[model samples]
Target: MDVLCESAPNDDDCGTRYSSSSSEDDERRDQGVAMTYMTLDSILNDNSRMFEFLRSFGVLANKYVCATCRKPMSCVKVATTRCGDGLMWRCAKDKVWRSVRKGTWFEKSKIKLKSIVLLTYCFCMRKSVQSTCRITGLSDKTVVDWFLSCREICSALMKKRGKIGGPGVVVEFGESSFGSNKYDKGRWMAEVWVWGAVVCGKDHGELVLNVVEKRDARTLQWFIEEHVENGTVIYSDKWDSYEDAEEFDLQSFAADHNYQFRNKVTGTMERYWKEVKRVLEGGKRRRSGLQSHLDEYIWRESVFVHGCAFHSFMQSVGALYVPRVED
Candidate 1:
């Protein structure tokens, strides 16, 4: 909710890149099984192109209805103004004026729309913060803040959607620890435990990454019951905590890493941890924001099967901001 910039800059200085036919190209490029880097020219040619694209996906609303009078409002700004760049609207009933970005993620945001959109693309792409900062010409703090916000939206949506694996599905379960032993003897020592699972698919799969307090049987059981579906084939290493998984109506299988009959599903999750740590640069000083990093990793993994990760994420933004019963 906080704007990470000192002041919002004009469109030309925002470093937004786009091509005239880039939207069509995006549609075509996104059809691949793996996500590829989009050229800046292929991303957005003009400022309004991104706005129009969001609208086409129903991420942005068709009408700007007034909140005060509940009537469809008409634009009060000049025809040439960007829709999201502080354009004004006039209520049909009360004749009151309102800023277009009054209540959305763009509200109180001091970053350009194009930069925001590009930052989102970079996040979905799982690019490093330093890399994204260089590309967008944004401060490291600003880009990190924006990436965390997007992760918040992804986390909220994942929670709303509930558990992943179901009947006949193999859900790999694992517990891992992060942080170095050099700090272990000092007051700065931090032991971070992360419990995670993956619903393995042939090409791409969904994952659940949770930061838990303890790695005990009680804790693991509670996490599994809360986040995994009933009758799922839960696979894991021979950890003592997972020994009682069958007590919870799940098909539990345990194996040792040295054994030939190791579970492939759990293997994938191990590789995932490597990729996650690699992207976060070993996640050394990010103890406080570990969950956000996990959320970003999970969300990025979920999008590999789909062509347009950015568009899918944009569609999620509307529901992410909507007031939910749980919230």
Candidate 2:
């Protein structure tokens, strides 16, 4: 929640892009599958458009009920204002004033709505904080905090998506250590071990990557039980900790790394481990923030693999911030 959105500067720069029906189609491919791609330049150049974009998706509140009036408020533009967009929620009945962003995800933000959208886009693209700062004119701290918020969003999404693989599903899993004594700001850091798994034989399988204190049976079993469903076909290396996998009613298979990384009968987790290591190694953060990066990596693989990264992420923003009506 360390959001640092700076207020938008151009108060009168509202555009009519939101009025166009075709604007929502930007994140789609001709084949109907989502392929969210929007340029930073395109987002940075507009303030009102981003507000409208978020409004279209309900990330920003569409309407408000006045506390005093107890009726719906109209979004009216003030003649002179500096709080990002010029609009505010106004109730004609009681002369009560409210922010259009009130009670929404953007309520506490100090930056333009467009910048928030741009930040999510940058996160989706895996852009560095420095480069994102240059592109979005956001401070490093702001970018870092927003990126962390994005990671938190990823973690929440993962929990909501629930565990991966089920009965009759093949799951590939492994354990690996991440650390570098060679150079981490010229100091040695502790090794961080992570247990990772994926739905095998699929380009975009369900995933689970968790940082563990140790790789013992009790420790690994805790995460394994949490992240994976029972009755899954679990493939792994010959790690003794997984001896009790069947105790949880799981179907377990082991590969002997001494002979080969993979064999027709046993090994399937080699490629999955390679992908996880590749992502973890690509990060520039310290061991402390490794879990965030790993969570974000798993989230991206879960979402972006469907070719709907930015769009899907924005929808998640809407779902989280928008109040739902109970049936």
Candidate 3:
């Protein structure tokens, strides 16, 4: 089987280097096989290939070492009637049947591991649920569930990264309402308030967005305290809610929308609002899991700006599962 090697910073020895001797060539070929697989065809056509790729991350192994006797463990494939039989590790000393996915996202999930990976790929590519379902030949519900799983994982990652703003960082803060237009006289309208803060830095920096109950001063102040760092200049449009920002120990700047303050950051924030609205564009706006959808946008925007959405999305998957400690 042909394998592709991903180049890293150190390219002194790269791309499956070969030697003149037959034995050396065979060794080099084996090393190439060990490298990560990327093609969709390879992953889908060969279940063993997909399992080998995931095994490299220790996903199939129960634990690196035995918890009871404090000894190294070995994992071997066991027969099962499930979607696919996973690895069952036996402690070299204890011989315990430990689970590889007992606590991770895949625990108790009957979905095939390869299918999950493909779902993640499609979601990260920003394909709509319908399109993803069609492409992957998965049911709509299954695709939606996997997409939300990715969003939840990415949300955790966003939280772990902490607030985006620091000293002297230019942060654009804005609040907008989602849902139906209130002006329509004949129809009932329901609106949900959303607060977003975008930090300006290289590669789109970071974004913190949340749903809020109200757009009052107290709510705005709480959002700043929770998501914005101290000493960072905050930008927002002229709104009564943000008037007391200074009192809350925040540096504030307001551009009067009426006067057409065309600052680039403010314009950028407006575009962000537009982009979000466009994503949620439809006649009926009272959608379930709105917050998750918004967060998915944040994750996609951040990764897209860096031009490595797929790589980052896959990395985020690895973060969701932790390796067992070695004794």
Candidate 4:
């Protein structure tokens, strides 16, 4: 045996090699951790923690004064609590908490704050109210109420924010019908005729659905004029109602698609109509309060645009209301 102890396999060298390998593994793990933290899904999943962490930065506070009485709300209770799913609060007052704003929408709703937050998230995520109810384990009626409250808020916010169109904006407008009745050859069946407009650049538009007596040019034109600004470049499917656009100084284009408006410019508005139809016709029996319920669906659709951060978008929408204090 050349010295009978082969120098113990160079203990220092082996230790150094092992340390180097461990260091490399640690670096790889750190990289993976960094990548995960940078993803939107990860952020959304951890929204509760993120919100709580953000409180330290003073993001949640009693900045909103009551819109009704104009009194400065003194306290804000921000927390993540559970009921149906998980509720995140940005409420005013300490003990018996209430949202800082009021009167515009979501007023006096007894639903848990978490339910509202989850409902809003689902709605923004394109989940229908029925699906939202199922996922959150809430009653259909409660889900409908949440939808209505959201819609009321959206409508109020949009009006306060002003007309959807800015100057020289090309806005596409169209009408579509939803719901059906087989009893009266679908004539006696109540149908909702939806009028919608989409602005080209601004992620802003309006939709109004009602039980229409007819779909004439006057009705269509009135709907367009009410929602879109004058002088917008309007496109429609050769409907006579659109023929009078020249009077309103709106540059008009007639699409060749009959009974179906196929202008790509109008695609967003058309998709919105389709989404509304899906909500109404999807398996569930049409509720008696469908129109009132649909208002929230429309509002939710309008607010959730591509590239918008859903949570922050809702917060901004929430901020649009001046808080109303009850006496």
Best model number under lDDT: 2
Q: Give the whole-model CA lDDT for all candidates, comma-separated.
A: 0.62, 0.64, 0.59, 0.46
Question: Residue by residue across 1-327, what tens digits does model 2's lDDT show?
Answer: 011122433445454344322333632432232423444345444545655666767776766777775677766655335455556666677887776677778778887666777787777767789988987899999999999999988877877878877776777777767774455557766677777878877766677877888676667657766777766666665444445644532233222211112212234456656766676563334777888778887777676546557667878888876742111
Off by over 4 Å in 2: 1-48, 79-82, 241-268, 282-284, 323-327
TM-score of 4: 0.50
Instruction: Flag clash pairs in model 3.
Output: none
Candidate 1, residues 159-194, lDDT tens digits: the string is 776787776678787777777544433645377888
Candidate 4 lDDT, 1-327, residue by residue in tens: 000111243323211110111122343232221112123233334334333322222323324454444555432223334222132222233323334223423445666434555676565555666788787789888887676655566555555544455345666666766555553334445565656666654444555544445666666646654565544566555444445553532234222211223344547667666666776663122435555546555555554453333444456554764334442
* CA error at residue 120 for candidate 2, angstroms: 1.8
TM-score ranking of the models:
2, 1, 3, 4
Least well predicted 10-residue stretch by lDDT in candidate 2: 254-263
| Local accuracy of candidate 3 as per-residue lDDT tens digits, 121-219 | 676666688988877789999997888788787777767767767666778877777776643557755877788988765455477778888777678
TM-score each candidate.
0.71, 0.77, 0.70, 0.50
- Flag regions of model 4 displaced more than 4 Å: 1-107, 126-137, 164-169, 182-188, 200-218, 241-276, 279-309, 324-327
Which residue pairs of candidate 1 clash? 18-44, 18-45, 19-45
